[model samples]
Target: MHLFADMLARVHAAAAAVLGPSADLTRIVVEPPRDPSHGDMATNAAMVLAKDAGQKPRDLAEAIAAKLLADAKVEKVDIAGPGFINLTLKGEVWPDALRTVLEQGKGYGRGTVGAGKKVNVEYVSANPTGPLHVGHGRGAVFGDALASLLVAAGYSVTREYYINDAGAQVDVLARSAFLRYREALGEDIGEIPEGLYPGDYLKECGAELAADYGDRLKAMPEAEWLPIVRLRATDMMMAEIRNDLARLRIVPEVFFSERSLIEGELPDPFSKEPPKPLVDVVAETIAALREAGHVYEGRLPPPKSGNLEDWEDREQTLFRSTEFGDDVDRPLLKSDGSYTYFATDIAYHKSKFDRGFADMIDVWGADHGGYVKRMQAAVKAVSGGKGQLDIKLVQLVRLLRNGEPVKMSKRAGDYITLREVVDEVGKDAVRFDMLYRKNDAVLDFDLAKVIEQSKDNPVFYVQYGHARGKSIFRTAAEQGVLPADPAALQRADLVRLTDSGELSIIRKLALYPRMLEAAALAHEPHRIAFYLYELASEFHAQWTRGGKESPHLRFIIQDDPQTTQARLALVQGIVTVLASGLDLLGVEAPEEMR
Candidate 1:
């Protein structure tokens, strides 16, 4: 029962009837009045549709007001300056909305904005080189929460992780692992090379190689043993990555390998044959773009950065991305006649479109901001303007402890690992703190501040709100004032809840469904975090007012059980909404704080 949605529908219907059924009512919206003293809700329908109605804004507002005043829920309709319509719903409407919240429980705020559209969300595509760092944690938490939010809004989403296995970095990883292999065989390897990875986590991979084939890999040539070592090291590293992600409760449905796009084969899922010929997707993608006149051999001007020393003036295969709104045309091949990174990226996204997904989202680090336009252009050219690609760039995190920068991990050798952060403080604190700010802004994560059991910490404050609600039920049942069963509590008389503070809590709870839909459409999970904090703050304030302002406003009254039961019903609504909103952000709602 979304109150604003219902009222907006009625306004649209009335506007259509008065404007001859052909009016553009999409712009008409029902929202809370900017100033609470004005009214409960306000609409701009009259102002937006007055031109088509061929009447003054106030005249149309009066006619629409007349139609709305007849509604049972709307108690009063007032016309303000220049065609603004303000609606004040009946007092009973608030109680009925609370009853709906109790009836739905955890399913209270679920919406239907997505309508079952298939969306592919690819995130945390960190290379299988080593352990994940704090920067990777931000993107992982953002993408995972965004996927949960879309599902709550009725979108069929697939969580994916793109494995960057085929690149020069993995070669460097292989060389680094080989040194550890020599050390594992009881050889004197004093120091790691300057260009290779120095993380001590690779020692386990080298030890495994030694245990499986003792002195066997030492005799083989570098070319022969490189592939064998690369496979084993990559498998071991990916296993470690999975374990790390599991600690944070993040499990991606698909782990698509980047190497598969170029070297491996993809079978046509729609083919009649069991196993068709191995298709070279990258080559086929380039040929298709060539046929469509989007690909050609041309020389790009020197880069705008003025670093022309490394620039080559010779003609190379290029993609005409400037025609599709990119800054300039992009190259598809390097000087050595090999496919560029952008070329393979285009083919990978085309594969997502081929698999029946028209909406795709990629979550990348802040450093990848310059790559968004080119990728979007490629999606437009490859999908024939039918597919949509949205790229979200997550900024880096500054790890701190008591206002001091935390030192880097010895195991990772350069930066702090995500595993270490989760191990120190539980998953809930890490996740909520990461999403407490916008994805595009710089976040300062303080280890000491997040674990404080005080109002300054948002995670603790919100979880305490849930615990406080449960505490009221426990205290009430102890005094034999009311039953703890939700079914029995739902039958409580809600009309007794007439306090302005109590109604304020109900109004906040009623806005959850609308906030969730807007956040999902905008691809921002921080909105959910912010909404939960505000609701918790309001509930806490109302609880304090009960003790300081009036005794009759208290939740549990020993002499009268009816008012106590009614207040408990309000608590039920508060806890239900708080739990649902916390779950969407991948945070836990605890039953008790201590």
Candidate 2:
């Protein structure tokens, strides 16, 4: 149960009672006291609502304090600062929270903060030109973990990938595969010419074309062969990408192709009719914006910092993004009358809105930070302010081995692929290390250190903590201190866990639901990773403390079976929370670590 959320609701109700039901309670927040000496929770209800209510902050606090004094759960209410209400709950409340964790087990930290809202999270939309790289892995791991986090918080989330198959890059991929195809047909294709994909991955596509069509494709003209080859190469590359994503366990619900947005008859491949707009999505988006008065013909200013070598000033189709909080108006088309990347993206996001996603999140590389404002403004213009677009930018990744930088890859010849990293270190290490830091921050993923089974290794430490909890349960069973069945062990007298260390761990366990709620609201899965590390550290600290001079704090006591069972229950609580959190992170919580 969300104890703090419950208390905040009570505090809001008390404020409403004191200052009429019409009082605005939105600004008030009840949070854990920074300095634990103050109280369990402190609220800023009076301070936030005081000026609007036309009363002194302290006086308003006193009035609300009087109303809260009658609550059965509140042992004391201390007023501090201008109007902060510090509340200390009954001591037994902590023990009751421990019981709640025991009873909930796997469901201990499940939260309902999302209220079953539908959210679409699109990530790892890497160009289907090649295998996913380590940078893409960060986004894949992050998006998967974020989706799982939202599910834990009661949101129905759709994980998606926007396939960029219609771009010029895929045409390049087609040309590259054609070279390999010629090699397959005994043409002895020499050195891969510049400006075409040189990766060996497309050789399979070349071989497949040779095996399926034999010389049929080679006999066709460039235009006819190019279409069939581009489609085949893109499909094969996308399949390879899906296989790599499976290594990381990221299965996107939808692979929305960018080429599918243009919904009209294609100009005949044989007919030379100047390619009738092909049901341009970009044109449709511009028309919609024009109808809304957000689109206009305008010229954009030149670059701010770069040399204006090729800068051209001409009136063109533009979206008035400045009206929606963007810094400037954005171009919707290039000089060639084709849709720019921004225009197609606008159509893509609008399609998401069309599919019933009121809330949409796009995980992008840090280089795309400048692209955020325009996209958000476009969503506002398209959805008429009914849709929300949240873009998270993941920064660069630095791959290292031990303390030395590790670079280059045999597969891609330029950089390490995502599958290579996953093969070098297990998926758990790759995913956990990627998320152990914030998305916006640059990450240093050390291969050697990540695999080390030390406390310094956050993933191993947390997994080891789960294994240690299992060890305690096994020890308890062998000593006949508790039953092997978890349901029976949960029947222990938890009131016996009065020690400060035991209560501290129990309090940490109680914070899981609140942590998950906050993480989901903030759209940050790193919070879960960081929380798991701290939880493991606290558990290990208590265990080491017990080994030192605190024998009474030991989880297993030979003479006192009841106390042992109670401590074993706490161990089970730790294991349940760790496993649940690890499961959310797509990390394995091993019963025993080797």
Candidate 3:
């Protein structure tokens, strides 16, 4: 069903016949002609291979064209200026392409580009200290959509969430909750400390603790009560986060805790009978890197950016990150002998490799942009170049209401929660708007605009396309257009779909499989959103044109049952693709807009 891919394979075969088997066909691409008058599809096989073929580009193009014309599907092959070969397929090909869409239905665009490769996508790994904010929503939607896209492209994807629970931030969360706990016990705790969390969300956690353990936790010292409170507060916050993620319909398969990397001991993998002494993964990672000459005792120069508070003119345990393309050798341990964040991160990624994942993707917030290179370097060191780490940094989401900045949440105090946005505008609007732009680019999410049922609102426009398609089928059945069933519709005379507007819809449908494969390969789910909008615009325009034009151009023709059925098949094709694309983006394709 990938028309471009199929044509590209034929083009490659023609090139091999002319230039012989040793020719490199990797650079050649088959794509739709930019100018419709040029041809249906265009290829640059001759231009790319001319120099190595010892021939003029035009001469090579002519030879390739001759070979291509021999194929039954190719009606004409024209060599353009300097040797870009444009192909025009037979008239029947478009109807056959439409047939492919009708027959395949929901399976139309499923591709094998990934070839079942195992890929681990870790996204929305927000700290469990608080509720997820709008910024985290962008990462969540991007990561989840990318995972779904990869799955559609035939990749075995594992959705993961790395919980950042082993930091000083959680301690602050516990202290904040303890204050609220004291308040729960009818004690006056005035003014939250400046360093502690200020969000009112922790009040519920405080109330929960008070309900469970009463004043028992109040009697213990900070050392004794801190662990209990931290554990309880982190669990409560994480539960809230899970609830919020559910609001967005996102469920990550694994929630890997960062604390587990350093706190727990793993049984030696090499030992059998009675297991050897449990090994610390963080320490083991350091030792492995040391043995591999990737770790060393070194002193680092002052940083080129940010504060030098952590920098010292003393020897420290360091990873030779610069050797693997980092900006500098990274410290593995703090001055107090505890492992640094980078060290624990190295162990965590190493654990991913140990768990049969050689391909790892981490979806990070904009603030972690600078952390990419060192983490990539660590993956290389730990996996010994056998692993690949692709880090996608999702930029900030600027929330607005009718072009003005939106206010912060009362619950979160300083930021708006993801749950608030989802609840207000619905997850479909939040997700589609978030992914309608590229991940690396800053996205402006307008609250008032998203809910507007206008073409300007992409979420509504695209969903309406599906809704409109279903409406066409309903109208057809009411008008008593015979052969409304899918099987009979598939048998409709599709060659009657010779109108330019009808063919345009089929062409766009033909591009879905190719566009999906490209989007999956590029790790950009926004491409799907963009394609959906264009497809919807095309469908809407054609429908409007039919309304204004003669009755024969309409989707439901009263006198001509054949054309109506063919048009019905086209609508079915559009609905199938719209639903499939929406599913990949984690949005719903409704039968009706209301």
Candidate 4:
């Protein structure tokens, strides 16, 4: 059960009764008090509604407080500050909440806020030109965890990756691989040109091409040979990408190809080239927008600097993005008479809409921050206002050791690959450390600190919290005070858990479902990471206090077996919640630290 949600509902009911059914309760919120001494929870029903209800703020607060006095859960209600109503629930409620945690176990935080609504999350759509870098890794882990969070919140989510195979970058990759093929054919292609990729990763593709087709590809012209090599290189690169994602336990359900929107009539890796079909999605999409009066022929305003380097000022096909929230209209075609990247992307979003998804999320790199407004406008224009696009921008990551910057290995690639970081530290550390901050904030990943056993290392600290909880259960079992199995521990009377330290863990566990719901709704998976850190901190604090300050407060009270069972039960509840939250973030919760 969501304790805060229950209190929020109760507060709303009390507000409705006091205001005689006309009060605006939309802004009313029941949250924890800033000072725990003030109360367990607080609400602002009077301050937000008093002006509309024709009463003084304090008077309205008193009336609502009086109404709330009848609630069984709320033990005390005080009118603090100008109008705040702080509530202290009966102490037994905390134990009951913990009992619910034990009853639910791994499913403790599961919620139904989404009601099984379909949500399409497109992320890590990095081009298949090379291995995914750490920058791409941020979006990959963020999107994968966001998908998991939505599923826990009862949303039917589709994890998708849009393959940018139709872009020019892949063409450059094909050319780079072709150069490597020449080298494989005993030709010294001196220092790779500025326009092509120089990564040694492509040598394998070149070797495979040389073995498969021998000189057959070389016999054809660039126009014919490039397509076959492009397809082959893209296929191999995507396979490598899938293996990388698998290393981190991310397997996207859909790998949608941007090239598929257009007919891949270039050539098959084997057999003769398929004939080009009479389909151009880009043209069809532009025509559809033109029919809807959203597309037009216009020239964009000059750059803000007013700089023009042999720029042609001719009219081109434009989308009236200004009609939406965009700052200016955007072009659909370039000067070379080919579709712009935005054009094919508009088609991709249209395909998603056609597949029956109205709620869409696009996870992109920070460099694409400026693209949000235009893409949102495009979705509005294409989906006819039925589709909503929320783009999450992930900022850059700086790899460092201690305080100094960490350099990439020159042998791997031009930049640090996600696989390198994941391989250096295990996948759990890579994922959790990345998500420890908000998605938009620039991240500093320190290689030396994440594995440390101190409080500074969040992944280690949280996992230690889970491990320590089990350690307590083991200590209790040695005293013959509790059962060895967790299921057996659940039968311990939770009401015996009356210590302040014990109830503190219970309150923290009760907040997990609420955190999951908020994180899922806000599309920020980082909140789960932050909440786990706080929960672990609380557990560690209480554990240290028990050992150092008071022996009676410890879990294994030999004289009072009842209290020992209860404390062990609370530990089980803590471990259960930490494990559940960690799983949502694709992290590991170890039972033994060693």
Estimate TM-scores for all models.
Answer: 0.94, 0.95, 0.95, 0.95
Model 3 superposed RMSD (Cα): 3.7
Superposed Cα deviation of residue 361, candidate 3 (Å): 1.3
The better-scoring model by lDDT among 2 and 3 is 3
lDDT of 2 by residue, 1-594 (tens): 567777888999999999899998988887778888997888999999999899999999999999888998899999998788999888778767877888988887898878999999999999998889999999999999999999999999999999998768888998999988888888988889999988888888899989877888777898788877888898898999999999988899999988877643334344567865656676787898899899999888987867687456999988999999998788877788777789899999999999999899999999999999999999998998999999999999999988788778888877888889999898999999999999999999998999998989999999999999988877777777768577876678888988878888887887788888889999999999999999999999989988969888899989888888888888988999999999999999998888
Question: Model 2 Cα displacement at 5 (Å)?
Answer: 2.4
Q: What shift in Å separates residue 164 of candidate 1 from its native position after superposition?
A: 0.9
Q: Count the backbone clashes (under 3 Å) in each candidate.
A: 0, 0, 0, 0
Candidate 4, 433-531: lDDT as tens digits:
999989999999987887788999999999999999888877777767768576876778788877777777788888788879888989989999999
Winner on lDDT between 1 and 3 is 3
lDDT of each: 0.88, 0.88, 0.90, 0.88
Q: Residue 501, candidate 2: how far off, in angstroms?
A: 1.1
Please write out the lDDT profile of model 1 over residues 160-247, one tens digit for every residue. 9988877678878888899899999999998887999999999999999899878888998887677677777887898988888878
Residue 215 lDDT, candidate 1, scale 0-100: 83
Positional deviation of 183 in candidate 4, in angstroms?
A: 1.8
TM-score of 4: 0.95
